[model samples]
Target: MKTTSQSRMRMVPTITNETIIALIGLYCLAVVMGYGRFLFTATLPDIMTQLTLSTTVAGWLASVNYIGYFIGALIAMFVPQRTTWQTLMLWTAMSVITTMMLAIPSLPIMLWYLVRLLAGIASGIAMILSSTLVIQSFSLERRALLSTLHYAGIGVGISASAILTWWLLSLDYHFDVIWLIAGLSSLPLLWLLLGIRPDNAADANPQPRSIHQTYINFKRSLYEAISGNGKAISLLSTSYVLAGFGYITSTTFLPVMATNQLADTYAGLQIWLVVGVSIIIFNPVWGILAKRIGEINTLIGLTLLQALGMFSPLWFAGALGLYANAIIVGMTFAGMVSMTLNIIKNMNPVYSNLLIGLATLAYALGQFIGPLVTVALAGDNDNFDAGLLAAGIGLLMGLGLLLWFRQLPQKSV
Candidate 1:
């Protein structure tokens, strides 16, 4: 009886290797991209009080972070092949260091900019490296599902920040303490992600190349990525820029908007929490939907949904509208990102990193531009109506780009 039972147990599938790698990737992203990169926005209101910052200054700081992100992506595109593990480790450490640096009370605004900027660079590199390695660990058939699970980390990080900030603030923790807590929370994730390696077949048996050869290879990949799929990449880049502008403007100001409304002291928290929850729930839904309906069609629908969500709060003007806006915008932003990257990956599997890096660069540019313009338009009155309208229009422009992508020939890429 014992032998028979053991045999049955052996037949069952336990946690697979791929599952472990995916979890590590997800955790790394949540820590680095979610906590390290975005926790700033979650805690911005509190930090603003401590720093005595103006809206315009705060917006410019945010833009500085995006600029850092763009530079990081540009660097990642040239990262010599087969060094994914080293890249991940270095950037993950930078993430931890930068997050903790923000915990310093009474720091100069310039220091804050530098810290956040470094965090953004860490996040950009970590994002592409983890995505590339984790996706490589899974089979082609299972890639989409695992990729969605990986992207869900962003939402998970956002939700975690919201809950933690709410609880800590309720307990009367100061801004410095909250930043320290967030930094401390990321420590364990580093150890957890230590085992995830790039198992890419192409990278498995890497041959050492001279510096010149490496430079040549990098140039070749960049040229191939652009020349091979110029039209598709061009369209994707424009869409990414619009998406970044639309989403960042909404997210950056939502908490401030909620506070100005004076609806409830915790109203902003609740709304941000809802946005995070919706993102977590919808990532997989859109992933599966893309599988069924095709990525192109899914992108078109989600972009339109996002545009509506961007403008909904201004149009409806109530708690109900705010919640609807949160759900729609949060749900669609990540889906649009996932679908867009998937399409880019499909366009040229070999140049996936180059393409994704380019897309991220475009995204960073949009994020950089959005806040500067929004803050300028929204001087002391806390009025973001004009900014929100512009965000919505940006999404509509993105929708037009997606339509254009669809109209191209089958060999467009």
Candidate 2:
């Protein structure tokens, strides 16, 4: 209804309302995904009993989500150019909500598997796309603050789920209720987000990369990360895979690992909560440091620290050792989740999501394989010293990849 010049003037952000709304939407999606994910993990024993499942079957069922995640990220290329970030977020919220409502103890195993995989894929695309939007929406100076807060969503969601689980489990309530509650909570968030759309994606009309190009870039990145193809292509891909294994081992297996090291009866939810709280506190600190020193150096130093934290408790068993390991490992590890995308953004401004999708595939593979491998390594003792050691190797591999990336020409990354 307005003149063209007037419409142009209105497009300028005077109060930054749109960006703030988009970030809120991001935080909301994190809550849904984080809660859904941890609730299942923390309540696995009960789920196994109710569903009459074996360990391998359960693992496959759980990991199906990661498979869906990879497929969804890969398919992002086919999404229409007119796709709005809001639409993706809305779909994610809806998928989680519906899946939870329909999820039941008597549901068929294959059906359960399908839902989990689809949910994982939806959540993966939503998370990655939300992150890209957050980065592009803000100025450089405000980025650290926004990024730290955005990353904190997982921690916050985990914390919320932890508290809810504590109350529910203490009262002997079923986990299905928790799932229903998680899904319901997200509905309002989506409703609140109905009017918001990302301005960042509005200006950028990047052509989607072909699947072939994705593989080529990923192969090149992987080759460089591992073989040091001497292009200094950002970190080696194999090493990144290993490091991802190490990081996931810490988050996914650390509670069980702690039980072994210290011989204490720790609840998985409680352990996850402590880890999440620690991450919430430290992510901002890391972001500030990254802003000052640089994301690359911060990544290098943190990876080393993460490696040490992985095996520390096993090396010196005690309450203090376990607690220290939890704080340190949780504090440093998710940077992998956040940083890889940031690094890809730095490396190829053009093919950022494709690179992110490729990197996420490596990460998903690491997570899928890492926990199972750790379980195998634990063997008779159910002691994860062997797993911890393997994690160290993975961390070293990831560090090597990061270092290799840094040495490459700035243009290469």
Candidate 3:
């Protein structure tokens, strides 16, 4: 047996090969699981038509995932930090994949809600844990790079789901067929993750001093983060809620709205596909820009772009509007998700995890509220004009709140 002195020497380094593998694994899972969460949105039209779902029911189906997600955000804290990332991802992905496969649009609303809730919980756990896994596994220096890559997966997943949906719809395949294909993709990923293990989940960055140490370095870090954004987080929460309300309702109904009162609707899925691909390029650009221009200003630009994209439905009737909206919305939406994290990080590095959880909550809340609000306005005909008007109102409200966000005076560099 090794001596106590020898054991101490072996535990010195902060990062290892296991850390790198975990990063890549997290990145891949981000794509796979994201596709799982979002495929429903991508295939909403088919789901409604085939399952004979009402607008409210369909919106709830999509929003239910967020409800599960909201619950998962709280549940995540209870999970042992020392748990294996592989097992965590595996279990989470399985949860998403299983209910997703079992989902029958023809089923009663109650059963449908249950599946969405379960999926939300699973995907929520996996995504939150994945983000946590990357942060915990790497040193501070590489965290930003990893974050950029992380949201990039959302881009990839969006593109894949769009293209896949388009391909199936074009081939005249049934909507259920698409779900089967999407769910089966997870099986191979699960097999690949069989041997992978995660690093220690304990507070690796704990201050080097004793438990009794007052204001330890780690605690100080938390203080600075909380201090910087304590009030602002509340503001951030409000901004995100409004933004989520407007953006989710508008974006969720994008393809549908674009097709509304228009005769040309041939390539909506393809247009959405292009938006996904654009994010692969745009997310990193926004990241670098956020680091330079600061998060507040960059976020303003991000929201503005989304606002512009939202206007495409009204820009011109027919396919022209959709084509324009898809391109603009896709690009900005990509940045919004990635940049939100950057914004939270710049405000407070120590509470990044907590903030992430909070942001997730805010976003989920936005989803829950957005659909209900939109459906109410849409009336019985499924016209989203009221929702769109409310969306504008929400965006303006978010912009006003953002002006109050305290930060480094909108940096130029």
lDDT of each: 0.79, 0.64, 0.65
Would you list the clashing residue pairs of candidate 2? 225-235, 225-236, 226-236, 235-401, 236-401, 347-413
Q: Kindly report the root-mean-square deviation of model 3 from the true structure over all alpha carbons.
A: 6.4
- TM match of model 2 to true structure: 0.81
140-219 per-residue lDDT for model 2 (tens digits): 76776677777777777766766666677677876677677767666655544443454453454556798798678666
lDDT of 1 by residue, 21-44 (tens): 777777787788777767777778
| Alpha-carbon shift of residue 127 in model 3 (angstroms) | 2.2
Predict model 2's lDDT versus the native. 0.64
Pairs of colliding residues, candidate 1: none
lDDT of 3 by residue, 22-64 (tens): 4455445444444656777678777777777888888877788
Order by TM-score, highest first: 1, 2, 3
Best by lDDT: 1
Error of 2 at 103 (Å): 4.6
Give each model's clash number: 0, 6, 1
